[model samples]
Target: MSNPLQLEVERLLALGRTPEALAAGEAMASDWARQGQPLRALALCRVLLQLEPAHTRTPQLLADLYARPDAPAKGAPPAAAATLPRVPLFSQLGREPFMALLGALELRTFKAGQNLITEGEPGRSMFALADGQVDVVRLLEGGERRTLASMGEGEFFGEIALVSESPRLASVVATRHTVALELIRTRLERIALRYPAVGETVRTFYRERLLANVLRSNPVFTTLPPEQRQALARCFELRLVDAGTVIIEQGQKGDGLYLLLQGQCTPVLRHPDGKQSAFSSLREGDVFGEISLLLGQPASATVRAETPCHLLRLGRDAFEQNLASQPRVRAALMRLGTERLLHISKLLSGRAALEGDLRV
Candidate 1:
C-alpha cells in the first residue's frame, strides 16, 4: 500500500526542495500518529526535527510521540546535568562552576512564533537553548525582516546586550515550542560576586564573542589569524560620543583607529579658505582614522557624530605593541590607507579643476 504523505516527502527531497520535504515529513508523521503507529511517527518526527530543528511543530510532535504507550523507557539524568553541557555558551565553564550557574538559571518556555527578544529593546538577560530552536532576525531599512541565523539546541543569544547594556541587536523568535534557561544580569552579578571564577568565565566568553563578531563582519580583518584578532580586540577601549560631538578634528594628529560599533559619523573636509564640505558618512562597523595611523600624520578630515555613537578605539601604542607582529593586518591597513589617500587626491583635483573653470 502506498503512503501519499511519504511519497510526497520523497518527491520533494528528490527535487531538492528541503523546506517542502520537511513540511511533508511533518504531515506524514502526523498521519502515522493518527493511525496509532507511535514508533513510526516518532522515527519520522526525529528525522524532521534533525533537518529543521527550529521548526516549532516538530519538537512538540516528538514529545507527544515519546509520551505514547509504546515508547520505550529511557534513563535520563537530572535536568540540569543533562542540559548544561549542551549549551555552548557555558560549555567552557568548569563543571563545578557551570553546575552552580545552571542552578541559578530560570527555565522558561515559549510557544511557536513567540518572540524571545526584540531588536532595539533593552535586554538584561541572556538565554541558553534547552530544547527546540529559534530564528534570529534583523529588521531591515525597508521594513523587511531578514533571518540572520537559526539556532538549535545548546546555542545561545542576548549576551551582547546584557554585557554591553545596549539594546537588543536582533529579534529572536521561537520556531516551535521551545525551552530556554534565562540568566538575568542582576542574578549573574550576584553569582559573580560570590564566585569569582564565574565572573571571569563570563568576561572571557564576552570578549571572545565580541572579537569574533567584529572580525567576522569586517572583510579587512578576516584574513588575520584568530589569535591575532583576539589580541587586537582586547586592546580596544569602548568610548561613547554624543550627537554633534566631534570625534576627530581636521589637522589634529591621529592617536588611534576608531571602529564605529554603533550610530553614525560624517567626515568633513575643511579647505584652506575655511569652506567645509561633508564628504562621506560612516555607520556601524565602519573604521576611520586609519590613514593618519598608518602615516603618522594629522587627521585629514573632521568626523562628527550624527547620532550618539559607541566606538571601539585602538590607540597607537596598543596597535604598535600588540598588533605589529600581524603582517596581514598591517598590509590590509596600509592598502586601505593608500586607497583613501588616492580618493581624497582625486576629489581635490576635481575641485581644483572646477575652481579654475569658475575663474576663467
Candidate 2:
C-alpha cells in the first residue's frame, strides 16, 4: 500500500503550509514508529525538528524515536541525542526553552585545576556551568591569594567580561571534573539579532546585578531601578580627568552630558551681567551638562574638577544612536521625560496657588 502519511505530508508541503507539513511529517514518523521502522521515523523526525525547534511535542517524540532500537542503524547517531555533557548543569539547560537558540554553544570539558579564565586577560567567550565546580579567585601581591566564591551546576560565569567589555575581573579555575557550554561572542551577537528581547532581558538582568555589586563603589547609579537614574548613567561615557582639568567653559556649545562617577568637582554659572555664582558642588553620582544635552543649547555653566575625577560623558550623537537602537531604553527615557514634565507642572500649579492666596 502507498504510504498515506507521507502523501499527506507531501500535500501539505505542496500547499505551502509549513506548519501543517511539519505536523503531517510528525504523524508519518509516528506511524513509522508504530511499525518499528525506527530508521524511517527518525529520518522524518529530523526535518521537522530543524524547522521548528520551539515546536513542543516534536523534540520529545524525536527523543523517543531516536531512543528506540534500530534508529541509529541507518545513520550516524543524532548529534542532539548524544549523551549531554556529563558535567553538572549542561544537561539541565539543554532542556530549557531557549536552548535551541544556543545551538552555537559548545560543550567543553576540562580537568580539575584547569583555568577557565584568567584575571587581566582578554575574553572572547562566556561559559555556563553544566557540571562540576569552579572557583573565583584572585591573586594578590606578595603571592597572596583569596577565593571569592565557588560556583556549581547551572551557574554562569565570565559574563562580566563579555557584557562590560572589560578585562576578566578574577581568575576562574575548575575545582573538580568540569564541563560547560561555551557561548562565543559571534553566536551571542546572532542571538541578539534573532532574539533581541533576549538581549534586552539579559541587559536588564546584568544592569541590576551590576547595580547591586557596584552601587556602593560607583556613585553614578545609586538610585536603584529608577528609569531616569539608569538612563542618565547609560547615556554617557566615562572620562578620567586630572585635578587641574577644565571640564567646561561658561559660554560654549554644549555637545554632551556628563555624570560624575568619582572624585569632586565645582560648578560655576556665569550670568549675562558678567558675574559668576557658585551653582553647586559636584560629587559622585551627580550629573550636569544634561540641561544643554537635553535642550540643544549652549553651556550656561562651567565645571572644573576640585580633585582627580572620573566622569561619564555622552555626546549628543552617541546618545541619540544608542536610543535609536534600544527600544527599551527609549521607552525608559520617555517615561522619565513625562515624569519630569508632570513634576514641573505640579510645581507651577503650586506657585500659582500661592500667588492667588497672596492676592486674596
Which one is best on lDDT? 1
Model 2, global lDDT? 0.56
Q: Which portions of model 2 show Cα errors greater than 4 Å?
A: 1-100, 215-360
Clashing pairs in 2: 87-131, 88-130, 88-131, 89-130, 89-131, 90-130, 237-313
What residue pairs clash in candidate 1, if any at all? 56-175, 56-176
lDDT of 2 by residue, 240-309 (tens): 6888787987568877756565567886645455655453367655556644555565655678888767
TM-score of each: 0.64, 0.40
lDDT of 1 by residue, 1-360 (tens): 224433443454465537777877878777765554433444454456446655646445433333322222254222323221123444455544544554456646677899999899987898876566799999999899999899976566787655556778789999976766678888888877877877766766665566568777787788877777777777887677788999988899988888887778998877677776665578767778888877888988888999877777889999778656668877877776776666566566654322221100
Tell me the whole-model lDDT of each prediction, alpha carbons only.
0.67, 0.56
Candidate 2's TM-score: 0.40
